[model samples]
Every structure is written in C-alpha cells, then in structure tokens.
Target: MEGKRLYVGNLTYSVNEAQLRELFSKYGDVVSAKVIEQKGFGFVEMGTSEEAQAAMDALNQTVFEGRTLRIDEARPMQPRREFDRGGYGGGAGRRY
Candidate 1:
C-alpha cells in the first residue's frame, strides 16, 4: 500500500498490543502494534510498506480470535472541523 501502517479491525476485546505485534511478526518485522481497548480495532505498523502489504494480503478476511479480521492500509487522519454552535445563520431572525 501507500503506507507502512495498517488498520486492523474486527478484533476481539481481549487482543492486546503484544499479541498483535506477535501476530504480524509472522509476516515481517512489526514496527509497532496497538489494540484500542473496547473499540474492536487497532493499528499495526510494519518496518516497510512491503511488509505491511504482505501482512494485509495474508491476514485480511481471515479468522482471528473468533472473528474475521479486516486489515488494510491505514489512512492518515483528517483535521477535525470546528463544531457549529447554532443553526439558521446563528440567529434565525430572533433577537435576544
């Protein structure tokens, strides 16, 4: 893929960082692994893009921890937009 980071989804609640790292190490050197607790997802980074692709190819749609894993290249986070405080142009023609 375009990046070495991978998005690992459909994870069981019990999976941890060490377990994820170990699971991916089978494909290549795992740079990092983090399982988001209670989120049923995580991120795994490999030493290189090739390694990450290999992991994704081998692991995607496979069963792990009693669930099918969904693996793919992780996308970069976009900046969050500021929340709108009110609707109707902030006034709605009503005066305070």
Candidate 2:
C-alpha cells in the first residue's frame, strides 16, 4: 500500500525485481519491487491496500520458478546497533 510493502520469501536466487513486478502486476499496479541481493529475499510495494490484498490473496502460496513464495505484510525495520558497542573494546561497561 501507500506506506507498506510485502515481504516475499523463498524466491529463486536469480529472480530480480522486474520479474517480481511482472508477476505481481497481474493483480494490480506495483509501485516497486526489490530483491535484496545479499539476503535472497525481497519486497514489493503496491499502489493501494486493495492491490496488496489482491496480490496476497492470489500469490501467498503460489509456486514460482520452483519455489513457493511466502508473502506477508512487511514489518518496520529494527533500529540499527553499533557493531562493536558492547564487545571487547568499546562503550560504557568496560571490565576493570
């Protein structure tokens, strides 16, 4: 929808955003589709809640390219943590 995206998982490694968009566009207008190269998962943004709902209804368990896609409402990203914040050499609780 306007402020939300769908989390699509179990996708083929070689599949890209365009392929995702093309597949989902059948349900409605897809605002954007991005496959995170490192994580092997991706997100799809739709124009409206209706479109998102439609996509979910039809594709939640659909098999594509030898994998069944798991689609769900995307959650907000967790806040970032400093990589070395509480480890051996950093930050507030240093051992004596």
Candidate 3:
C-alpha cells in the first residue's frame, strides 16, 4: 500500500478501537485505530507503508467478528460542500 492508513470495511458493529489496534498490531506498529460505531467501518494507521500492505494482505477478505473484512489503502477525504436545493420547497408556502 502507498499510504500508511488502511480503510477497514464490513466490520461488525461491536468492534471498537481497542480491538482494531490489537488486531493490526500483529502486522506492525499501529499508529492509531478508529472505529466508527454507527458506520460499521474504521481506519487503521500503521507506522509504515510496508506494515499497511502486510496487514492488508494478511487480513483482507478474512472473517472477523462474524463478518468479512474489506481492507484497502485509505483514500484522502474529499472536501464537503453544501448542497443547493435549487429552490425546492423550503416550507409549506415556498415552492418552485
């Protein structure tokens, strides 16, 4: 992997940061682990690209917590922008 960060998907809802850290630590030094409880996914930051790749190779498509894991290089997040409703019904009296 080119990036040190890995995107972990298809995670079980009960998985947490500590569990993620413990899992990835076997491959190499884990910089951080963050599990989004509601999204059912998380990001694991490894100390190096090699470690990230190793983790990906070893864990991707493997079953964890009764779910198949989807592991890949984490992509940079895109900037968020406010959407324009284009004057679509703001209220009972407003319509276009």
Candidate 4:
C-alpha cells in the first residue's frame, strides 16, 4: 500500500541483503533486501514512497554484477495455488 517495495530482477545470484541495502542506500533508507535463490530475483522495501521513487529513478539503469538492475514498484502478491488439483493434464482419478 505504501509503494515502498520494489521488484528487482536480473540479479546475480550472489547478491545478498547487505550488499543490496548498501547499493540502494544512496537513494534512501532500504528497509529490506531479499534475493530469492529459487526465483532468481528479489525485492527491496524502502522506508518511504520518496525513497522508492528515488531508487526506481536512479537504479533502474545501473548495472550490477554485469546486469542492469530492473527496479519497479512491487506488484501485489498473487494468491497461492494448490498443486495440480485439476487441469488439462492427467490426475489420479483421470484416464489417458
């Protein structure tokens, strides 16, 4: 709701929380930085909207680990889904 979190993608897997915070701290207070290993992307939450905006403005084109940081306002998380309940593929009760 605060538009404080940013969607950061195309990151090197080695980038960690402290480095991310340090990198973006120039813009403002970085509340949190999470680099998800599984998803190969991460999120950065700032202390305020202005901080978020500054990060987005300054960091979007900056390269890190040989890749440019893609920073944007974080989207609302989608609802989680259960595994393979029923779909086009076969299920336990279905026949091929």
Candidate 5:
C-alpha cells in the first residue's frame, strides 16, 4: 500500500522469519522477513508494493501456524514521547 514493507500480524509465537519468507515467496520475491519474538507478529518486505499487495491479498485471511494472518502496509513508527513526572527524587522509600 504505502510502501513495500508490510506488517504481518496474527501469527503464532512459534512462527519464525524463515517461515515467513517461505510463505511470502509464493507471491513474489521476499526481500526480508523478521519475526518479533514473543510478540506474535512480524514484518515482511516484498520486492515491490505490488508484490506486497499480492501477498496480502492471497494470505491476509489465511491460516498459518494455527492462526489467521493479518497482512497490511507497515505504518511508520511514531516516536515515543517521554513525559516528565514532577521532580520527586526517590521519595522516602520504605518497602511497600
């Protein structure tokens, strides 16, 4: 959609990068694949947006590793904003 990078969700914890590559490769060239450990999700970068779309179209609702896959364009990560908690320097700590 937006770019070649695609966000692959609804994955089982056991799914790995190589599995992703193998699955996506059917639609087109898999540029890269990464499985976020313990997150049950990963990223797959196809050779082009068209490839990504094809993969998404074919595999979005398909079951893999006992779970339905959710494929879509990866969104740019938003920067985390740090909030300032009032300067309370280690208030009298007594094991709660």
Candidate 6:
C-alpha cells in the first residue's frame, strides 16, 4: 500500500463511521473513518501504509453488517472539469 487511505466498499447502508473505525482499528491505528450513507461505501485512513495494507488483507471480501466488504487502497480524486454549454443555450436566456 502506497498510502494510508483505504477505500471500503459493499458496505451496508446502516454502517456508521464508529463501526468502521472500530473494525479497522483491529489491524492498527486508524486515523479516521467516514461512511457515506447514501453511497454504501466509505474511506478509512490508517496511521501508516503497513497498517492499511494489513487491514486491507484481513478485511477484503469479509462479511460485515450482512454484506461482503471490498477493501482496496484509495485512489486520489480526479480533478473536475467545468462543462461548456456553448451551443446548448444553457445560460440565463430563453424560457422553455
């Protein structure tokens, strides 16, 4: 693992940050845990890369909260580009 952050997927919608933090803490120090309720996924940050790797190894494909978990190293967020509406007449102009 290159980074301490891990992307946890296949989580039950009911899972919360506290539960996630407690689960990952078993492998090592957990810096933070965040569960995106609507998305059914979350991110966990460990204190070190080794810890993150260990957690990933132990937790991936494991069942939790009635769902199988998917764990992987978190990827960096891609930059968002502004959409151009040149020909679509998307500005303040004509009422439909």
lDDT of 6 at 54: 94
For residues 1-96, what per-residue lDDT tens digits would candidate 4 score against the true structure? 369999999888888878888988999988899889866579999999988998889889789988888887899999976766576543756667
Q: List CA RMSD, all candidates.
A: 3.9, 3.8, 3.0, 2.7, 4.1, 3.7
Better of 3 and 5 by TM-score: 3
Candidate 2 TM-score over all chains jointly? 0.79
**Prediction 4 TM-score vs. true:** 0.80
Model 2: pairs clashing at backbone N, Cα or C within 3 Å: none
Lowest-sum lDDT 10-residue window in model 3: 84-93
- Give lDDT: candidate 2, residue 6: 92
Worst 10 residues of 6 by lDDT: 86-95
Provide the lowest-lDDT 10-residue window in model 1. Answer: 83-92
Q: Which residue runs of candidate 6 sit more than 4 Å off their true CA positions? A: 85-96
| Model 4, residue 68: C-alpha shift (Å) | 1.5
Candidate 3 lDDT, tens digit per residue, 1-96?
Answer: 579999999998999999999999999999999998889999999999999999999999999999999999999999986554554433445554
Off by over 4 Å in 4: 83-86, 89-96
Candidate 2 regions with alpha-carbon error over 4 angstroms? 1-3, 82-96
lDDT score, candidate 3: 0.93
Q: Any idea how many clashes model 1 has? A: 0
| Worst window of 10 by summed lDDT in candidate 4 | 81-90
* Candidate 1 residue-wise lDDT, 1-96, digit = tens: 689999999999999999899999999999889899999999999999999999999999999889999998999989977554565455655577
Q: How do the residues 1-96 of candidate 6 rate in per-residue lDDT, one tens digit apiece? A: 599999999998889999999999999999999998789999999999999999999999999989999999999999976655654445545455
For each candidate, the alpha-carbon lDDT, in order, equals 0.92, 0.87, 0.93, 0.85, 0.89, 0.93
| Per-model TM against the reference | 0.87, 0.79, 0.87, 0.80, 0.85, 0.85
Colliding pairs, model 3? none
Q: How many residue pairs clash in each candidate at the backbone level?
A: 0, 0, 0, 0, 0, 0
- TM-score: model 6 vs. ground truth: 0.85
